[model samples]
Target chain A: MKKSLFIAAVAAALLMSGCSQKKPEVDMTKQETTETTAPAATEVDTGVNSVVGTEESAGEITTLPEDERMAKIKELEASAKKIYFDFDKYNIRPDQEPRVDEDAQLFASDAAKDLTIKIEGNCDEWGTDEYNYALGLRRAKTVRDALAIKGIEESRMVMVSYGESNPVCTEHTRECWAKNRRVEFELLP
Target chain B: MRFFLILFMGVALFASDATLEIVKSTDNRPSVAIQDASEFGNIRIRQKFFRLVMGDLKVTAHFKVDDRYRESDYDAMIDPLLKDKDYLFRYRFREDGEQRLYLDAKVLDLSSGSPVFERSYRVANRARYPFLIHRAVIDFNDYLQMPSVEWMRRYVVFSQYGKPKSADIIVADYTLTYRKKIISGGLNIFPKWADKNQRGIYYTKLGNRPVLYYYNIYTGEERRVITSDGMLVCSDVSRDGKKLLLTMAPDGQPDIYRYDIETGKRERLTFYSGIDVSAQFTGSERKIVFVSDRLGYPNIFVKRVGDRAVQQLVYHGKNNNACSVHGKYVIYTSRESDNAFSSNTFNLYLVSTESDYIRRLTASGINQFPKFSPDGESVIYIKHYASQSALGIIRLNYNEGFLFPLKGHKIQSIDW
Candidate 1:
């Protein structure tokens, strides 16, 4: 049982390493250029990584120009939207799968190949701020792992929990609370 | 003895109509005269006292002050303008060590050349200067037949962030003066006054086993209020202090619950398939206002406290998250955008329960955790800026705004 547990842990670590390997490839290309050129390239690469992670995870990848990349980013953003939770629950429900799928696809796209994305987890105004923050992180991590499983690079994903501070809906309604429990994606360039 | 007799005689002469009559009232604002008596003692002490009093009165929105008194004006001839009876309010320091400060003021009717209201207040050096002045202003306003000054006595509770995961719950006067740390030693946030008297606070202390804790401010006593698997927060307390409307995710889904404080029993208030949080009681405890994403986006909803039946309150905004309810007034925070990447500015808004008279309170910054004053005439909210957060005040009746910047400290949440 111990040996099998070790083997399973190793396999999980290997999978994470395999997903994170995409980071060095993009970083190496940017470093090969001049200093000023390198920083801009690194930023662009990071942006692309975020775009790719989101796009490919959702199964949409197409190489395009700058304007089209932005347009696609906007489109993917609109498609990804936000996933709402049931009152008090941080776990994403089955009904929110389509929204998460869209977000994962956006992360998986070629245009997002080198971009880094931060998953911000949030909660409704029900619990303590610290617990909500941790809960938010859990929800964000759940989304982050889902994207990783969808082939988005793990190293390109960062997570932060705002807890109950950044509620998109301020009303006291189940509908509002559901909208508030969410993992939102921010592309870092 | 002679002074007492003269004062008694004066009082008897005008006791029938002693309340200051509004001979000529104006939204034009009341002009006030503040005298500097700093030379009687230590200069620093007098200057601090002067500044505190001026700041308090200025923020009231009822006073228009003339700060023409200079350092040389201390021992120099008292300006003729200082004696102008349109409205005269004077404060002086007495030599008695028992009382560090003494304020004597009289609002005189210029036409009659007689003092309409006169009173003397004394305070010790150890006591909060702002509190003394706040009480004085309340007296002044009351004597002027303005309105009630009950908010002056209410305790202001706020969370001050000291370090990462280290914050303290502080109780202070509304002006951010007279602060005392009630709870410290961990990540404590969302410090809400549990009772109407502001004796205890409900806050979440973050650790391995994060739970909601109720702390008594005066007694230094505390107890864990509730524990939840994911999150637990005491959002609002009922008027009679019998029930607490809490947001808890006991089953791993955030939902609103009504917890009876006396019995320590809770009844699930909301059962949304999606997130239902940020609950507040409204309309005689039979109704509840809460936020839900059942519509795929956060919006306001109202429902009967016991029944499953729900009604939507706000439709224009996609994200309307936090709210405070008092009488027919429902004050809530609304986000401007649905896009996560967009600059989502959260602003405080007020709407009547009977009608759709929506009035936006704040315009520019991210304002949240709006708690109505017990009197329901004002609101205190947390304002997040670029680098820091502020404990801000909004006087609903006066339509005025004042922000006390959280200097040398960061704010997590505020309840007054």
Candidate 2:
């Protein structure tokens, strides 16, 4: 059992590296990311053992389901913290550094290697739609860069901006707005 | 407090071949008395139509509406011009015991004691009765030879925020009297009319990838224009309806893009890292104007369609956005105070491309999403204060304003 776990872990790391190397350049203008570009990470099948094992063991060990895996993923997601920003600004606050660091640490660890970090950036009910969407994207990109600098692969990170669309709080008060201006860490397997 | 958006001349503007004149009212709006024949016996329908016509006349700013359901009616034969009224409009609905509404409208020149115009309109149905009132007002406005408020009958496409992460793109008349929900479900926003005929609209749906979709309201067909990584919006559609002015975040930042609807080709217009959004084609699409924060705060900026030279458009407000263009005129919303948390007091200002004839439209309470009427005689916008939303109209020639309430949902933005 220990040897099988070792082989599975090593094999997963190899697949992650394989996928990351083929990933397109980050700064390419989206117009050029045409039909020929590789499928996005979201389309990738996220079955853990399937991602780890070869063609032969992929069917056997991968099919041998572990009921605890989904619960474990949910547990980790529950602990995943959110990073907040100031009004009309996308810069991650200094006080949020530790929370970003924690997410980075989780993304970089072996247990979370196969996990895809979807950083949802948001804003309060202020700025224009296009501007807020840009701000939220900037915030998510800032968090992704922080995670990348802390040893997480960019391929394992996802950036989606909600702008002022999705709010965790409903009140119009400053406290509620601040709470709404945040980047939530969602882990997808 | 007045806002003077002094024009800057660092970069020369392309000389306009089209001449623009600020046509002021010839005289104070022709005072008019409206009388409704009470013998129709359908008091409810008559009053409803009566109020709609009176409100329409008041909004045109072309008349001092003397008929506010007053007890006494003005005599059309007498010189009402002496009584401070010029035109006398007496309308009577002739319902022939059949469940149909037909209005006989006649406008009498109170000065000459002569009938200027007379017409009878058959309402299509009860749903279209308001249009009958609008037609009467249009005839009255046109009889005066002033720019008609016929455009007021056009539909305004707007998106209003509802339940968390959801919005509905609604198409309503200028008065918000008639509304139809065109798109709903999930974060769809930034609905811009693709044509002057109000056939289709372009909006963005927030998903894993933000996509701009062109939906034909009549045909019920939808086509994806483009899928952007961060955000995308169709801000303005060109006169010919073949091209689109879009705000897209393609290179990790939001910038303006001109898209050819037929060819499916997009030309990146602005290459700014901070933000460039809400772009519109001005003066025949040769000059593109947009909002940018490159100077560290939101301000209006303009550049020619193919020229690389970016010129400062407005120099008064820190956050001047929500702009609309009609010919040489540009109307925008400017923040009044310096409180970043204070998003409550943005006002609308109108300026021309050739010169800075800055006209302040509103005094207070977040007057935003200003779109000019097709004739450029009136401006329609959203009035937001406290939790209430209202549709506001600025009769440019009259320098007067009127508002109608939009209850239940908060308006996000509007386009006509």
Most accurate candidate by DockQ: 2
Give the CA lDDT, 0 to 100, for residue A46 in model 1: 37
lDDT of 1 by residue, A27-136 (tens): 78766774566354323243334331245365567656887767766665555557666654556689888877887787777766667776777777554323345468
- For model 1, the superposed segments whose C-alpha errors exceed 4 Å read A1-189, B1-29, B39-48, B65-78, B82-85, B93-127, B338-344, B384-390
Poorest 10 consecutive residues by lDDT, candidate 2 chain B? B10-19
- Tens-digit lDDT string for candidate 2 (A1-189): 999998987888778766755444542444265657764544233344355445554444443245577777777887878998987677778999999889877777777789988888888876654667767877888888888888888887768777787889988787998899898877788
Q: Could you estimate the TM-score for every candidate? A: 0.64, 0.78
RMSD (CA, Å), each prediction:
17.4, 15.1
lDDT of 2: 0.77
| Candidate 2 wrong stretches, greater than 4 Å | A1-74, B1-27, B37-49, B71-84, B92-104, B109-116, B340-344
TM-score (C-alpha) between model 1 and the true structure: 0.64
Listed in order, the DockQ scores are: 0.03, 0.27
User: Chain A alone, model 1, TM-score?
Assistant: 0.58
Best by TM-score: 2
